[model samples]
Target: MNESTELGEDFKCKLPNVSMSTQSKTMPMIDLKVYIRVVAAVFSISSATALVMALLRLLTPNLFYVEPLDGSNIVLHYFITGLMVVTSAIGLLNSCVVMNRSAAKNTGRNITTWLLLDSLFETTRVVYVFICEVVIKGRGSLQTYEMLISIAQYLLDSFLYCQMILRH
Candidate 1:
């Protein structure tokens, strides 16, 4: 037999009665769907956690030791928290659709980038709050305790962003 005939026979034996063309088309879709579902679940959990934290802060403003409860603070808190949740949800949904169609090469990258950006924004906001609470409007110059806490938060944010970049 010729080389092509031998190769064909080997392929058929390995695959048994399965059609190569159908397997090629269906397996990828199945894998893509699974990947999308996993990604969505992860982002959904993160968003929910942030929402819960925001709710806690809103309800128990005194627990934060930041400032008096006011309208502007409430509005800004809700807005930022809501934006985080919404953006994460949208990214997950977009990823699902793209992966479902097996055309998410760039979409996945964009989602990752967006998530990183959101994390960075949160970090900045937290830092600003820390500075305001500990330095400018704070009592006296600065409390060592408050400074340590702010520094810790900043470190945590940096670590999170680094992880995100590495994952991408």
Candidate 2:
């Protein structure tokens, strides 16, 4: 055998050098739809929990020994909290829609507006709650820990929705 043949045989066990093809950097599965769906699920759950807690407090006012709060203020509180509940429900539905679309491998752009609106609505609710909680004078017992938690859920949902717009 020639010197070249012997050299090739000596390196027969080595693999041939194959250059990697250039692949366009695209968003991974977990980055966009998957990530937002997961966040949406958690956001939905948090909203539901906060809703239940707020309802419990509202129904059982005597449990906390809350003094008689202003009727108008109570009405406003219920209105905002109820709006939050509806917002959370919508978020949950949006997540389900996203999951279905993802399973079909065809996520659409329709949800972008909904997500943006949810973020705005939730932010408004959270801000209202924060302002009320700070400005209100004497309904300390009614505004229990659950109120803060409920507000937190709204905040989290708002943040998630805002983030989802970018991903969507």
Candidate 3:
């Protein structure tokens, strides 16, 4: 009877090794959900910052004195702000889908690619703004400083993205 009991204990221990294979099936889903949440948070914070910058420009006209707020500029301002809000909301929804396991691995990969692309575009936009302020507008306003700060932020974001990609 003691020999049988010992054998049963050994079998139970080995049973866990058999169950380990099933755990891998759910691990990717959990990892995808976490990645999506992290990306969504990044987008949310970025959108909030953009909104704040837009509002500051609207309230303090002297900060960017070169271009007067004409009809076209006002429209552009609102459009950009709307874009930020929309992107953040879309990211949040994507994260929800990932969390629900409705999003495939390919979909998660695509989202990650899009995020990196967006970061690149943002970097380009900052560089363009900085160039415009310094070369076209003679670098006389707070916009130049803001552009420099934005460039630094974009660099930091790129660094973080690289780290994430490498870690994954």
Candidate 4:
């Protein structure tokens, strides 16, 4: 009877170990690099969209006229879109630097600095667009859609900027 009891205790210990191993195997995994890549993809897409807008405005001005800058000429729109493309490209490059596992500490600091500048510029642009297009001129302009999209992009960039700073 004592030998049977000892056998049962050994079986119980083996069962728990098997269960623990299975639990660990079944656990969900999270990869931070994937998120960083996702942000980079978003930046790329934003840059592409801005580039397309710039091209459409340049090639076919009648089809893509901005209401706010209606009297000012399409040059302003082109300039704004160009700025977006440049900043988004910078953001993508910064994200790549961040994803490098062997990147030096100074490289990380540089990435953070670039992200900070991008975030600040985006924030200012959003506020300026909101105030100029929505507040002073009213929301009747067709550029409101563009303004909202830019605002969303700004928010996403700001989130990524915060993440980069926190991680580094």
Best-performing candidate as measured by lDDT: 2
Q: Can you write out model 2's per-residue Cα lDDT over 1-168, one digit (the tens) per residue? A: 599999998888875775563332352446565675677567557655645644654566454334654777667666655665666566556555655564445255556654654565466556545644664432455556656676667667767666666656
Q: Taking the tens digit of each residue's C-alpha lDDT, what string does model 4 give over 1-168?
A: 999999898887443335534654775543545655555556555544444544544455444344445644445555654565465456446545544534344345555675675565555456545544544443343445666676777677677667656655
Candidate 3 residue lDDT tens string, 67-91: 6656755565445444544553453
The CA lDDT of each predicted structure is 0.49, 0.59, 0.54, 0.54
The candidate, 1 or 4, that scores higher on lDDT is: 4
User: What order do you get sorting by TM-score, best first?
Assistant: 2, 4, 3, 1
Candidate 3 root-mean-square deviation in Å: 11.7
What would the per-residue lDDT of candidate 1 be over residues 1-168, giving only the tens digit for each residue?
Answer: 599998898787454676656755664444433544454444444444444444544455455544553566556655654554455445445434433544345356665665564565455446444543543333322334434544564465456445445444
Per-residue lDDT value at 56 in model 4:
48
TM-score-superior candidate, 2 or 3:
2
Worst lDDT run of 10 residues, candidate 3, spans: 131-140
* Reference-based lDDT, residue 68, model 1: 56
Model 3, global lDDT? 0.54
RMSD of each: 12.6, 9.5, 11.7, 8.6
Query: What TM-score would each prediction reach against the true structure?
Result: 0.35, 0.58, 0.46, 0.49
- Model 3 has a clash total of 0
How far in Å is the alpha carbon of 36 misplaced in model 2?
A: 2.7
* Superposed Cα deviation of residue 35, candidate 2 (Å): 1.4
